[model samples]
Target: MLKGQPRATSPRPAISPAPGASEVFQLLRDGQPRTRAELAQLTGLARSSVASRVDTLMGLGLVAPYGGAASTGGRPPSLFALNPGARAVVAADIGATHARAILADLSGRELAEERQALTIGDGPDAVLGWLAGTVGTLLARGGLPASELAAIGIGLPGPVEHRTGRPINPPIMPGWDRFDVPARVQESYDVPVLVDNDVNIMALGERSFHWPGTTELMFVKVATGIGAGIISGGSLQRGAQGTAGDLGHVRVAYGGEVVCRCGNTGCLEALAGGPALVAALNERTGGTLTSSQDVIELVRSGDAGAVQVIRQAGRDIGDVLAACVNLINPSVIVIGGSLAQAGEHLLAGIREVVYQRSLPLATEHLRIVPSVAGDRAGVTGAAVLAIDHVLSPESIEAACAALTTG
Candidate 1:
């Protein structure tokens, strides 16, 4: 079954007095057909209540009745399952250098996707305007009308206050401090707007789509900047202020020699980030290489200088992650982002340091691997965010109630 969105406020959502449509809907999330009696038995609700919930869900197009199950005697009971095409959401993954968007159905299937090179430095107005326009384009391409848009989920390359969908003071994102991103996009699309730090959403995407079984996981993004998406207890950790995984600014041994975009000196990002590696490469080879993609290509082509630099960056990241193993003790560490694509050198450095430095008990079953979701990590995760919100028991109850009233 697809994982629901994590709630930071509570370990789990509160249960209602009786099983609601959300509970009945969850019974069919696995695409299995079940009779009202089966759902009633599972949820401990009366068959009539289960029937009512199913009817409400069917009216909302989230549930559909199909066929029937075998019966011991008399007539077979009808079965109901979740409808994948019931609703749609627009998912956007915005980075410092590029932007991507996708239109996805209730089942998290991408109906349409588009990508373009853009800079977050262009500021919020330009970026959000383009995002709003992209959402419309995706809806049209996917043949979904505006009425079917349930919500919009976005991942921004910055620290975001999840409740308000506003960016905090982000180093790489200029003119986006405390900017109301949801409001800007909501002007174009009236549906709910959800925003989160890009890497956090990527973690959600990676886990929901690929590693749903892993209870404890961490998604480490090594790109133009550095960050980690920590999953403990099968839920995303947002910390006290929602910046728990901000690993880039951790102080390192450089000792104020290097400055970061956040105006800090001796940050890990300044030491091992993409720009740092690029600068180190240019200084050594006297070649002007731009972006994390350039460093990746150089390393792929067997440039020893680029290889050595990326490896050390991995070690630098591992140095911090080693402490993470001791504290959080995750079962898996997934390396992703542009720099992680530089081949085994980066992974080798990380493994070498992580295993060597971490506790024996912690490293015994720890698995450090590269990301499988690739570029789809952000958008898929964005979709997961929207999907979790729109299909949640509370949201479904409200929607179903509205349908019944109408």
Candidate 2:
């Protein structure tokens, strides 16, 4: 089990300054910009101790005093915030149909972003070359030097071998297996590179931004394919080969003739994925539905046929998720991807079956909600990964030394 936040601080504790200083820095990173006195109150340290730590951080150019507080019959307190330009990161999200790149500051605010339709199946070299060019363009446009970039992070549509930083035998992504994506990206930029599955990155984004207090969370994306990201016990569950949450290939209906890209039959993806749903709808209505957007518009217009198709697809998806819930018992289930735009019709079907089939204790207080991040989740998650990787203890110390000496 994962531990929760530490207990609240009491006034005037004799806390050591070294650990308190790092904690104070983390608090600021967590979006709590406070004065010395406010930080002292939160860290159970004296005002003088907080001031000493703040002085050291300011000397290192990592923290900056923004402005003074309103006077309350006393000296105004100086507010402090992290220096946004102290370091930067490059984030990339490589999906089946498209790829996006962004240059983000230390504060995780995007400085520049670019997206283009990706013909991923062409080969690994072509795809990587495209990503490198786009990243260079983004950096140049943002007027940021390559030296200022601390690290690069990529989220790919396939399973990643975390230790080796290579994609595995991913079904949908052709010619990506055995590719050393991180090493290749690092050669171009001369910075640390991190890579993971897109769903894992999305899960990180949700845990960091959307639901801060929760530890057990699940993000289900029903897009061109159906997949999930599992965050249990405050740690990502990257199974033996870092392919734990590849739910797209889960066999929902066995012995069916429909073939999946994975060379499997009757997988959940073949039943309720974006392509599957659109094909089903087109077959029934005898109309041409080119994309998931077409299905969303028809469903929104109260087309009974469209509604029925989506509802059934949702139920099919929910059945698999119900099994997942019974096993993982996550606190929240976030639904994302293009099909999620179907709204209540889809959610209702999922909720109905999940509650009916899952154990009472597992889902008694579970909340199923739509993702707030939407299409940007993958890119933002990639950015967060890069930021966190660069901000690790050893990396931070090295970066600080490099910047200070230079």
Candidate 3:
């Protein structure tokens, strides 16, 4: 079943007393055909109330009647399910080097997508403008009208104030500190917007799409920067300042002097990040190599120099994550990003240190693997986030009222 977006407020949303509409909707959303009698029994509401809620959902075009279910003795009752085509959300994954967007339905199914090479360092105005155009082109390609859009979800490669949908002192993303990203994106369309950390959204995608029922997971991205996405108890754990998984800035146990982007010396990112690895290789072999892609290809072709560097880099990452594993006790550790495409060499090094250093209990059930979704994880997670936000009980109540009044 597709997950619904929960309210981001302190107090939980109020229950819809009228026929348990939200409850009924969730029942139908489970991708199974359910009868009013079954819903009533499950929800402890009257059959009449269940029927009323179903009527409201159908009226709003949120639910559709499917073929009938077999009956015990009487005539079979009709079944209902969520209408995936009722509304769509725009999902954007903005990286340091490129931007991608997708048009997805309420069920988190992608209908259209587009990508372009652009740098986040170009600042918000230029990037967001480009983003707006990219979204427009994608919507056109999908044959979807902007009027059908319910919300927008974006993942930026930096810390974000999730509440206001703004970046907060992003080191790599210049001129984006406290930028009104949601407002800028929403200007073209009147809809709710959700902005969050790119890695966090990637973790969400892994959990929601690839590994359902995984309540505890960690997504470590080894790219131009080294960062982690933390999921504890089936929810993303954004710390007090929305930088819980800012693993790049962690101090290495033993490292040579190298200044980091955050102005720290001997930081993990400065020592073992993609840029650091690439610089080390280029300096040693007197070869000019740019981007993590080059390093990934070298490792893929079994270059001893590249393989050795990546293996050491993975060990360095594991050094930091060993502590994290002890603290978080995640069952799964998923390594992603461009450098992760180097495959087993990286994984082997990470495994060596993680298992050697972490507690026996922690390592017993831990499973370290590569991301199956790859680059698409962030956008897919963003799409799911948008759909969930628009389908929350509060939003659903408002939508139902609008449908009934109209």
lDDT of each: 0.86, 0.81, 0.86
Please report the TM-score between candidate 1 and the true structure: 0.91
Q: How big is the positional error of residue 198 in model 1, measured in Å on the Cα after superposition?
A: 0.5
- Which 10 residues in a row give candidate 1 its minimum summed lDDT? 5-14
> How many steric overlaps are in each model, in order?
0, 0, 0
**Cα RMSD (angstroms) for every candidate in the order listed:** 5.8, 6.4, 5.3
C-alpha TM-score for every candidate: 0.91, 0.84, 0.92
Using TM-score, rank the candidates from best to worst: 3, 1, 2
> Where does candidate 3 have its weakest 10-residue lDDT segment?
5-14
Error of 1 at 255 (Å): 5.5
Cα lDDT of model 3 by residue, 57-134, tens digit: 766667776666888888888767787777788999999989889998877878888888999999999998987888
Question: What digit string (tens of lDDT, one per residue) describes model 1 on residues 272-389?
Answer: 8889999988999899998888999989999888889989988888888999999999999999998889978999999999999999999999999999998789999999999889
Cα-based lDDT at residue 176, candidate 1: 96
CA lDDT for candidate 1? 0.86
